[model samples]
Target: MIRTLPLLLAVLASPALAQGLTDLDEVDRQVSAFVGQPTPPVDRRLRLARCTAPLALDWYGNGRQAVQVRCPVPAGWTLYVAMPAAAAAAAAPPLVQRGDSVTIQVGGDGWAVSQPGEALEAGAAGAWIKVRGLVPKAPVLRGRVLRPGLVGVDLP
Candidate 1:
């Protein structure tokens, strides 16, 4: 029992605890604006280091719908904020939904090929997702979700 006291003290004195805790509501508000959609409630067990300086929220990674919260201050920390799985699936805007028929346009330099395709994933406007081209043997392509039945692919 005595040996565990040092471990407990170390945890209590950690930088994360010293920085204080962030409010989940504030995190939701910022993430919602970034994603261009209303986010459902965050998990009750989610807690992050308080950011006294400006807080920057960015997408977690490619193909991930989560947000990364970071504090720019020295000795700052980062936290990943992901919406509840069920909420994410239900929150997609009406403009695009999973398995919807959409047009995939692949082009660059003012020229492109537009093909009829199917949306492989549900996404909001301006969100990038997988789309299956109609042509046989065609590979699934990534395109930005535009509107109903519309997806746009940008060529390099």
Candidate 2:
């Protein structure tokens, strides 16, 4: 019985056993609050990991076309929820212009790293645009426009 007890504990402590699938309804509510509008329900087919911490929500793609929902680490996952056409059409005008100096940030879990870069193209909020780090020999990268001069990149 003692041997079996250790085996049972191991199974219970496994990462998969530690987390459950995220609730779609909770995701919908959070997304709606982030966008300041009632967002469409999240697809039921998704099987995202349950977040032990509060999910991080952000704008994604050009013109508020989608919302990026992230379940931070220990259960890291990201899902993009598309907005209705009318909402996309109402997005604000371009905020980041080509050749502008910007901050490129790569974030995950509870940490983020940022560096200065130059925008290679103009973009509105949530738009994915090209940017090159100001550091010598840096490669061009694509990131989502978070604001006038802030771009965010997701970990691969």
Candidate 3:
């Protein structure tokens, strides 16, 4: 029989991968509300979807570059957007547990919740929807998904 050590080890040690690290999955879902997947880009334009989660509940890394920005909408083959909660604790300062609403910005300035199977466009990228309102700042001194997607991001 073939050595299954490597495969077994990977399986046993494998951590839960958040497919929709961004809000792409949620985008897909919300988009479905307005339009379906694989629809014309125009139809997918300007959709707004929101998510309110307790900081203690869910949070995940948005994978930042410089100012901990670039918190994109979920985009994955499986698992929808992994809330920043999963990544909150991993961040320098964990997100507030009270409540945070992450509104995914879609279709170039059109803010909406992301749906499953949808795509994240370069224009759709943003940071903390509730704050900052900056574009994606990456290669950060260090950080991960912190808050909602901002509208405009200024980096030094």
Candidate 3 residue-wise lDDT, 28-96, digit = tens: 444333222231122223223332331111222333111111223453122223323223223334332
**How much lDDT does candidate 1 score?**
0.74
Q: Between candidates 2 and 3, name the one with more favorable TM-score.
A: 2
Candidate topping TM-score:
2
Extract clashing residue pairs from model 1. none
TM-score of 1: 0.42
Better of 1 and 3 by lDDT: 1
Cα-based lDDT at residue 20, candidate 3: 17
On lDDT, the candidate that comes out on top is 2
Order the candidate numbers by lDDT, best to worst: 2, 1, 3
Across residues 26-84, which tens digit of lDDT does each residue of candidate 1 receive? 77788788766787666758656687897887765333456777888888878777765
